[model samples]
Target: MRHHIVHAGWLTAALAVLGGVFALYVHPDFLVTLVDQIWSCF
Candidate 1:
């Protein structure tokens, strides 16, 4: 039971992170800035 609870907690955190990333991609301004920053690194 304890193990299952820990697993569920990790899964919830992972989903939250993935959802946040998806939200970022959906925003065009963030996408453009991210690309610009990566290009600058090169």
Candidate 2:
């Protein structure tokens, strides 16, 4: 169970970083707001 949880956390972090990179490439201006929204989820 604990291993699964850690795996999920790492997966989520990786996806978030990918998302940030994509956002930066497509919409640099909104990256901050996009990240702010992501942080709000936490």
Candidate 3:
């Protein structure tokens, strides 16, 4: 159980960093457009 908790925490931290980097490097408009495209397809 402890191992699982640690793993989840690390994964969450890594994803947060990845999201920050993506937001900083990519344009917000592009991300919004991609999300819109995917959502419309669904």
How far is 11's C-alpha from truth in model 1 (Å)?
A: 0.2
Once fitted onto the true fold, the runs of candidate 2 whose alpha carbons sit more than 4 angstroms away are 28-42
Distance from true position, residue 19, model 2, in Å?
0.0
User: Count of backbone clashes for each model?
Assistant: 0, 0, 0
User: lDDT tens digits, residues 1-42, model 3?
Assistant: 999999999999999999987885678787778789999998
List the candidates ranked by lDDT, beginning with the highest: 1, 2, 3
Tell me the whole-model lDDT of each prediction, alpha carbons only: 0.95, 0.90, 0.89
Candidate with the larger lDDT of 1 and 2: 1
Poorest stretch of ten by lDDT in candidate 3: 24-33
For model 3, the stretches where C-alpha displacement exceeds 4 angstroms are 27-42
Ranking by TM-score: 1, 2, 3
lDDT of model 2, residue 19: 88
Residue 21 lDDT (model 1):
90
Worst 10 residues of 1 by lDDT: 25-34
Look at candidate 1 and give me any clashing residue pairs: none
For model 1, state the Cα shift of residue 1 in Å: 0.4
Q: Please state the error at residue 8 of candidate 2 in Å.
A: 0.1
